[model samples]
Target: MNETHAIAGVPMRWVGPLRMSGNVASTETEVPLATYESPLWPSVRRGAKLSMMVENGISATLVDDRMTRSVLVKADDAHNAYLAALDVAAQLEELRAIVRKCSRFTELVALRHEITANLLFLRFEFTTGDASGHNMATLAADALLTHILQSVPGITYGSISGNYCTDKKATAINGILGRGKNVVTELLLPRDVVHRYLHTSAAAIAELNVNKNLIGTLLAGGIRSANAHYANMLLAFYLATGQDAANIVEGSQGVTVAEDRDGDLYFSCTLPNLIVGSVGNGKGLDFVEENLTRLGCRAEREPGENARRLAVIAAATVLCGELSLLAAQTNPGELMRAHVHLERKSTSTTVGGW
Candidate 1:
């Protein structure tokens, strides 16, 4: 047998010197996006331009961050499963100590559980420092699971993953109880600025958001998601930065809020599951390292500060693309015209025209 490796190149661009101020990071930096969709670069740049005009630009606040892994145990009966849950609940300090032995950066922060019949699902949450914490959390969970099986009676190992952790899935549980970095990015654009840059009025954008994003998503049975194209921006940003692109499944489960505050437009994107890290498996590549360094994510700081900075920037980028798409949708034929002009191979189009 032989082994071979190859690289698939995605077109990359630095979209903005977007102004961002929050608990994690405060700076104006251009973000990189790698995607086949050519229009996204210009679209996000427009929103980035809008950010500079505002008072505070994008206020990206990191609400919470934790990585999770759920282990399943099968008890003799439902009664035994309930008892096992109670036993583990009483041993939080012991579990934390066990997690410490697994990795220096892995710290057991929280534990959640679900029981159905004789099966018990224990979801272990951890703060994994600069890494995304997937592997760290899993390693800790493995140790914890071994201890639980030995100490607790009548419970046998079922599986390492119980689907309760809800990794890479669009589940309501992930939204209700977050799995990754929860960031809320907001911008307050003045009425005139909205018209000039976005080519739409404040009131119109707000109304369209309600009627289109909110009501339309509700009618379509979208679960824990309300936005025009979060996946588009997330995919591009994740690909460029060497994140697990599949995590975009839950990452895209966000809400876009547009409010007409008097005449000024108050816009925000709340992304509850932004799973990214500065030092991790995919970060070993040269381009990934370069991208992280450029984004200021590879910095000498506190244990979790680097990952926090990465998450907030990702949230801010989502706000940029989401704002641009919503504004374009406010005008009839504007969306199609841009796509047609930019995407068609026969017609030569410049980025300036967009």
Candidate 2:
């Protein structure tokens, strides 16, 4: 028997010397091509990145700065991409500020505290987090609003509040307060060369939206509402790092976008209900566990728990998917070309099939 000490980089101390039945020890060849099999495959990894976006709402914009710093910047790559120009932390704080300012979400709907705001209706937030940031932001908004209401009596806080969550899908409001009626969503996409696939997919959705009233069916016309394209959510992230594929059910959100002036389209997605905590689940798995550690998201003293960092990661993922669909709809040839390019770049000996 050949002695082994580690599984997927999860090292286990070797207890004994190697023992082989054969007279001569077998020779093993180092396959450099196996590097392609690493969790960070160009395509699969990119998919993993987008899951972050699908899992979280953007600052209405913000990029995965950590990702850009690690993969592209560190490697000295020429170009890079991001959503909102502001740092993700700034965006998070901005949202926090919005909540802080509002003493209440609406009339007779006072918060646990009070605060203020400028944009009467800036964004219809998705509260992208574990369970719509229901408990998380609730605790926060409660404290902030409560403080302001008790202290700043002069502030004009409404009585109604907005936030939502649901153990099951029912009662359309999602159990959230301030569940506004004019909740418009866009399948956000980028106008750059690297992120234009969204046009094709967006077109497909648009066609459905345009004819929905007349034809009463979705894109391919299966069952309009059940048009689930969440396969990418699980496989992509699972193969990349340590995450429970099941959580994706609660964490995957699909939204649509329109209103492009230059004939270039944009798309955005939000999850708003992914309650993923780093320590509890997916702590053990061969390659999965190792992959998380390798990504440096997981580290000693709870380094993996950067909600902001995770949010940024999620935004990047949303951007990718939104762009992919849009591009596919606008020019399918681009996707074909991307596929061809990825295939060519892959190591033939290891990938084995065409």
- Cα TM-score per model: 0.97, 0.39
Cα lDDT of candidate 2 equals: 0.32
Report the C-alpha lDDT of model 2 over 1-354, residue by residue, as the tens digit. 999876454222111111111111111111010122232233323322333333232223321111000000011111111111122223454445655444232111221211122111011233322222333333444444444344432333332233122222322322132221112223333344223322233345445434541244244443212212333532344334444444444434333344443443444443343333333345456554554444333544323233333333433343344333333434536555555655566443111011
Indicate the residue-level lDDT of 182 in model 2: 14
Candidate 2 C-alpha error for residue 39, in Å: 14
* Highest-scoring model, TM-score: 1
Off by over 4 Å in 2: 1-228, 294-296, 299-308, 332-354
Candidate 2 vs. true structure, TM-score: 0.39
lDDT score of residue 169 within candidate 2: 31
Candidate 2, RMSD to the unseen true structure = 18.6
Root-mean-square deviation of candidate 1? 1.5
Q: Clashes in each model (backbone N, CA, C under 3 Å)?
A: 1, 60
